[model samples]
Target: MRTTLYGQFVAGTKTDEVKQIVDKFKQYNVKVILDYSMESDISTSITASNNVHKSSFNTELDESNTFKIYHPDERIFNTNMFNYIKNSNTSRELCGQSSFIAMKITALVRPLVLQKLNQFLESRITDHNLFDTIDSLLTTKNDFTHSLTPNELGEISNLLLRINRIIQTVKKNEGRIFIDAEQSYFQTAINKIVIHLQRLYNRNNLLVYNTYQCYKK
Candidate 1:
């Protein structure tokens, strides 16, 4: 690990070690942006037929139905969320106030699910009500899970929880977060989530940002 690109670009593996490097940069007035490097394990293509379950939002879901769609294991996702919260807190402490942290939506939610959601959103891109439905979900004022299957809704709920935790940590520390933009296939879903977060948090301060790639078509 110490002989290749990972060794050269990665700050360090441990918190203390990374802090040492960050401290050096701090001496020169350079702020550090910490990002967990974990990527989703799934890379298969999404199909149009795999649309979200259109059942009523209050419909009860059976255990068998949970895995009928794309969803990561509960333990794994929770662990990642915990690590994200802890890492962000540590990052804030290491870098001091107004620190910056980078996050990937793919890290919290399955990529295939994102693709499916993106496909659904793109299909309804011209519908103003669809956007209003999404906007209402920012503060949980209304239920938007009606458009998603129970499994997809659960996954999205978990993702929102994870992101909310991270956002609260960053806010308490007076730091900002940058949500990384992914491939075109998933960018639409990512943008929606980030924008909602921006609406909730940026109303007072620019605590959240969405990244745009110039190279994407």
Candidate 2:
């Protein structure tokens, strides 16, 4: 079913297939914005209340029982993005122009982590220390602290590292990346990460672009 739909709308399923599609597009002076269409689902059981408890801030990333079990695909997002980068690079060389890739943050980070972070940001605390506070809470585990468990922290760290790698790859290939807007629940975290990437890569021109879904408005 998906194959039929992909054939109708999507470029292709594999790298070589997509390259062929891109080649055909180049014949018409068209460019491609490669995208990995994986989106995270909101788990009914996972909530901000379940992860956060108290106001204590010190935390660390390690293996622990308190961390939420992550979806298996979370580990595979980076691999998919890596493949996309490689394909985009090939497409660029084939067409002799800039290539673009679209990303959905939920594909890289778990929705639960984003929910907890959003709750933390919305809380009556200092906004300037947001990342620091999140970092401190993510690095340590204590009964007195209300923050992410060691395993969750590790997962978040891995997600951030993967995002950084994607940005680095795009920069290296002289390509551009655009982040897709997701549900409202995850937008804040998405925006934060996108802004960070934009600051780093969008120095002279817009190497990173973030989409805002107007239909939601």
| Candidate 2 C-alpha lDDT tens digits along 41-124 | 577325533564434433432243332334443435555556656655765665454678887777766677777655654562
Candidate 1 ranges with C-alpha deviation above 4 Å: 44-72, 133-148
Report clash pairs, candidate 2: 59-139, 59-140, 60-138, 60-139, 60-140, 62-150
Which candidate leads the pack in TM-score? Answer: 1
> Would you list the C-alpha lDDT of every candidate in the order shown?
0.72, 0.65
Error of 2 at 46 (Å): 6.6
Off by over 4 Å in 2: 2-4, 44-74, 124-145
Clashes (candidate 1): 0
Q: What is the lDDT of residue 22 in candidate 2?
A: 80
Indicate the residue-level lDDT of 57 in model 1: 31
| Candidate 1 TM-score, true structure as reference | 0.79
**116-169: candidate 1 lDDT, tens digit per residue:** 678777876777555653535433423435455556666666677778888998
